[model samples]
Target: MLLVLVVLGLAAAAWARTASRGWGLAALGVVVVLAAIVLTVRPRPATRLPETGELEVGGRRVTGLVLPLRRPSGAQALGVAVLAVLFLGAAVVTFVTQRPAPPDAVFGMVLLAVFGVLFAVAALALWAASGRVPYVGLTPTHLLVFQETAQVEVPWSDLAGVAPVVARTGASPLPDAVGSWVAVRVRTGSPAASGVKLRGPASRVVTQVPGPTGTTTAALIGDVHWAVDPVLAWWTLSYYAEHPAERRELSGPAAVERVTAGDLR
Candidate 1:
């Protein structure tokens, strides 16, 4: 994650520098500070097992394990740490060597402020990533997706179809290959048979869901990218699909009741 931020930060700084060197320096400083915060505030791996629990809905049993998510790989962490040290050293050097000049001092301060903001943002991201699965989960009742601040819940009964999805990182404007993702179609119960779409990056296993009739008809879908384990997500979804009775559909006031009940558990 830090690596991604660093790359992006540098790219943005490069762009900013093309227009204004001072702004570019400020941006670089901001990126450096953000990287530092990320390195310091990341979540450690799970040291103890999560609370093994289950929720029953519609007569199906949904088991859950709250695992602690790590911030970044060890190698990635080390790389960021090293880069941070180097950047800090450079900043210090620039400050000391150029302190006599007013313009240089102002530039240094700008860089300092920029780095401060960047690190602050990185720290926030680390905190968010550590607390919970930002926007993904499998439950007996429904598939929950979090996009930014909005949350969407799709009940098993509403799931009309599922398809594979894949996303890759590259310079190509078009996706070169289909990897893993699930494109779920929900039934809106309208005359037009219209539905909503929810997609995630996951493995091919998502293509198969145990339904009343049998496993679902799997389709090879393209153009989806995921940040989490698609195979695990598939496992969770499959569990719910096989035990449809365990799921429930709640809205408005009912939704509040369901949450309250779950919290008491």
Candidate 2:
């Protein structure tokens, strides 16, 4: 996503070289909006929950909550590839057409160069993250989410609240246009809330720990469709947050089946 924005910025810079300054600025503005979308438009989970099963973690049963696989769609991959090629082609064109750098265009050229490097780095990161199998595990001790940026573990005791959030791209009578999500909040000063100090990229897109939501919670899972059963996702997480003792019951396949079945409704 970051790479996409950078590519657009570079393209805009190239356009600015030959076009009006106003046109260049307009292109940059669009790039900004696209960057915002990358942050706001949470992608739908590509896969359903993990298989209904149990696993032993720290001598206790832990249930694996399936996270959507992070692979890019064919269209997405092809689009990025094409964009990369175009960026390269543009670079060559710029080189071949090189004349004395106009003083006015010097800043633009530097900006383009910087953005090009950033775009490459972001593209590489996205590629590498795609290869890892990301997932979240629910256990009596903690809720573990392994993502591109980080592995987050939130203990049930630290949980503050859980609620459902509905976000929409546009208002319509159609249900498919609405996005359902689960928001979670945790007590301040907890390790999971603040996160352990780590180095490399870990899923830091949303707060792994919760925040204030004025009778609600932090916006978590989102861009969900009706088919994904947001209610079930909300119910399961909320139940665990509110009723820790009964959480162990969900460690069995039968229980998972019942919960999933209910979610379909």
Per-model C-alpha RMSD: 11.4, 8.5
Worst window of 10 by summed lDDT in candidate 2: 198-207
Residue range 119-206, candidate 2, lDDT tens digits: 5565566667656655545665777655556666677777777656555533234643545555555676766667444222112323
- Across 134-233, the per-residue lDDT of candidate 1 in tens digits comes to 3343454555444433344556666665544444523356644535555554554521123323234233234333223433322222222233344444
- Please report the candidate that would top lDDT against the real structure: 2
Candidate number of the best TM-score: 2
Name the runs in model 2 displaced over 4 angstroms: 1-50, 53-78, 104-111, 166-180, 196-219, 225-228, 263-265
Assess the local accuracy of residue 241 in candidate 1 as a C-alpha lDDT between 0 and 100. Answer: 53
In order of appearance, the predictions have TM-scores of 0.42, 0.60
What C-alpha lDDT do the candidate models reach, one value each? 0.43, 0.52
In model 1, where do residues sit more than 4 Å from their true spots? Answer: 1-96, 100-116, 133-140, 146-151, 169-179, 187-229, 235-265
Positional deviation of residue 190's Cα in model 1 after best superposition, in angstroms: 10
What lDDT score goes with residue 58 in model 1?
Answer: 43
